[model samples]
Target: MVYLAEFVGTAILTLLGCGVVAGVALARSKALAGGWIVVTFGWGMAVTMAVYVAGTTSGAHINPAVTLGLASIGEFDWALVPGYIGAQLVGAFFGACLVYLAYLSHWKITEDPDAKLSVFSTIPAVRNPVANLTTEIIGTAMLLLGILGIGANSGAVSAGQADLANLFTNGLAPLLIGLLVFAIGLSLGGPTGYAINPARDLGPRVAHALLPIAGKGPSDWGYSWIPIVGPVIGGVLGAWIWNLTGFGS
Candidate 1:
C-alpha cells in the first residue's frame, strides 16, 4: 500500500511539475512566458496533494533524505527506512516516466534546448556546484525542520459524539507543512529554487536523460550530486537541530 501510494503521489507530482513547465516553456501555450512563480506554486500544490494522499500510512517523506534524517534523530522507525527510500525512488522514477509520456508531443514542438530541459527536470541558474549545493541544503533543512515541529506538536481530539453531531478531527501538521514549503520558496529557494527533495530532483533528472526529447541539453550530471548530497546532509542537520531542542524526543 505504501509503495502504491508513493507511486501515485510521485506520478502526480511530476505530472504537475513537468506539465507546468511544458505549459510555460513550450511554444503556443497560454502559460508560455510565465516565470518562476508558476513553478514554485505548482510544486507547492503538488506536495500538498501528495501529502494529503500519503500522509497517513507512509508519512509521505517521498524524499530519502527525510526518511534517513528522521531515523537518525530517533523520530522514525529505523527498520522501515530502506523500504521507504526505495519506494520513494521507484515512485519518482515512474512519475518521471509518466511526465515524459505526457509531454512527448510538446517536446517535438519546443525548439529551445534549455526550455526543453526545463519541461522535465531542474537546472541551476549558475553552474557553481558549491553554491548550488548549499542552496539545496539550506532549502531542504528549512523544510525538514518545519516538518519535525509539525509532527511533534500537532494532534487531534474529538470534541463531540452523536449520530449527526459527531466531530471530525484534523491536525495542524499539514497546514504548517504547507506554510513551511511556501516560506522556503519565498526565501531560501532563490539560488537553485529549492530542489530539496532528492527523489524529486534525481528521478526526473534520470528521466530527462533517458527520454528522447529533441533539442534537450546535457542532464547537468556534473552537479547532480548536489541535490542528493545536499538534501541528505541538510535533512540530518535539521533533524539534529530539532533533537537538540528536544522536539524529536
Candidate 2:
C-alpha cells in the first residue's frame, strides 16, 4: 500500500507539475512562455494531492527534505527514512519520465532553452547566488515549519495521551499547515519557484539530464546543488525554530 501510494502520489505530482510546464511553454504558441504563478500553484496543488492520498500511511513525505526533517524530530523512524527517500526518488523519476513522454510532440516545436530545461527541472528566474540561496532557505524553512506544526511531537498533551477530540475536531492544524506552504510560495517563490523538496527538485533534474531530445539546452549543473543544500539547511532551521518555540506544544 505504501509503495502504491507513493507511486500514485509521485505520478500525480509530476503530472500536474509537468502539465503546467507544457501548458505555459508549448501552448503559448511559438516563443511565448508562462509565468511564475503557474509554476507556484502547480507545485502547491501537487503537494496537496500527494499528501491527501498518502498522508495516512507514509505521512506523504515524498521529499527527502521532509523525511530527513521528520526523522530529526523523532516524529519519523530513522529506519524508514532511507526507504522513504528512495521510494520518493523512484516515484519522482518515473513521474517525470511520463511527463516527458506526454510532452514529446510539443517539445519538438519549441526552441527556447529555458522552456525546454523547465519541462523537467527548475532554473533561476533572477540568477543571483546569494538571493537564490536565501530564497530556497526561506522557502524550505516555511515548508518545514508547516510540517512541524502539523506533525509535531504530541508528548506535551499528557504523559501518554493526547487530546484527540480537540485536535481532530478543530481543523486549525491542517489549515495552518497548508497555509504555511501557500504563504511561502506567495512570498518567496518569485526568484526560483521554491524547490523546497530535494527529491522533487533533484529527481526531475536527473530526468532532464538523461532524457534524449533534439536541440535541448545545456543542463545547469553548476547551480543544481543549491536546491539540495539550501533545502536541507532551511529544513533544519525550520525544525529547530519549531522545536525551540514549542508551537505545537
Candidate 3:
C-alpha cells in the first residue's frame, strides 16, 4: 500500500505539473495567458496536493530524490527505497501520458519540437553541460534541505517541542513545502528548470521519447543524465548537511 500510495501521489503530481506546461506552452491552449509564474506555482501546488493525498499512507515521497535522501540519512528504511522510487517513476510516466492525451489536439499545431518536449521534461536555458549539472545539483540540494527542515522535530514523527514539530501532522507542512518548491523555481529554475526529482524528469523524458506526438522532436537524450545524477548526489549531499546541523536533536 505504501508503494501504491507513492505511485498515485507522484502520478497526480506529474499530471498537474505537466498539464500546466501543456496549457502554457501548447498552441492555442487557454493557459497561453500564463507565463513562468504560472508554471512555478503549478508545480508547487502539484507537490502540495500530492502530499495531502498520500501523506498518511506513505509520507508522500512523490519524488524519488526525497525517498533517496531520507534513506541516505537513515531516516527511512533502505529496504523500501527501490519500491518507492520505482513507483514514483512509473507514476510520473503515466502522468506525462495523461498530459499527452489531454493536449492531443495541440501537438501537431505546435511546430516547435522543443516546446513539445518541454511539456514533459526539463530543458536547460543554456546549453552548457557543466553549468546545467551544477544548477540541478544546487537546486535539488536546496530541495532536500527545505523538505527536511519543514518536518524537522514535527510532533507527528518524534518527541519534541509541541509547537513546531506538528508541521508534518498539522497539515501546514504541505503548503510550506509547496512554497519551498515555488521559491526554488523562481530563484533556481532558470538554468535547468530544476529537475530536483529524478522520477519527475526521467520518467517524463522517457515518455517524451516513447510517445507518438505529431511533429515532435528528439528527447535531447544527451542532456538527460544530469537531472538523474545531479539530483541523486544533491539529495545525499543535502541529507548529510542536514544531519550535521543536528536541528532535530
State the C-alpha lDDT per candidate: 0.75, 0.73, 0.90
What clash pairs does model 2 have?
none
lDDT of candidate 2 over 112-135, digit per residue (tens):
777777877768889988889888
RMSD of 3: 2.5
TM-score list, all predictions = 0.88, 0.85, 0.94
| Span of 10 residues, lowest total lDDT, candidate 1 | 162-171
Better of 2 and 3 by TM-score: 3
Q: Better model by lDDT, 1 or 2?
A: 1
Q: Indicate the worst ten consecutive residues by lDDT in candidate 2.
A: 165-174
Cα lDDT of model 1 by residue, 1-249, tens digit: 876776667666667766777778888777888877776777777777777777776777877888888999787898987778777877787787776776667777777887877666667777788888888888888888888776655433334653221121124455556567767877877777577888877888888888777778898787778889999999998888888887555
lDDT score at residue 155, model 3, on the 0-100 scale: 52
Better of 2 and 3 by lDDT: 3
Preferred candidate (TM-score higher): 1 or 2: 1
> How many angstroms is residue 103 displaced in model 1 relative to the true structure, after the best TM-score fit?
2.4
Highest TM-score against the true fold, candidate: 3
TM-score of 3: 0.94
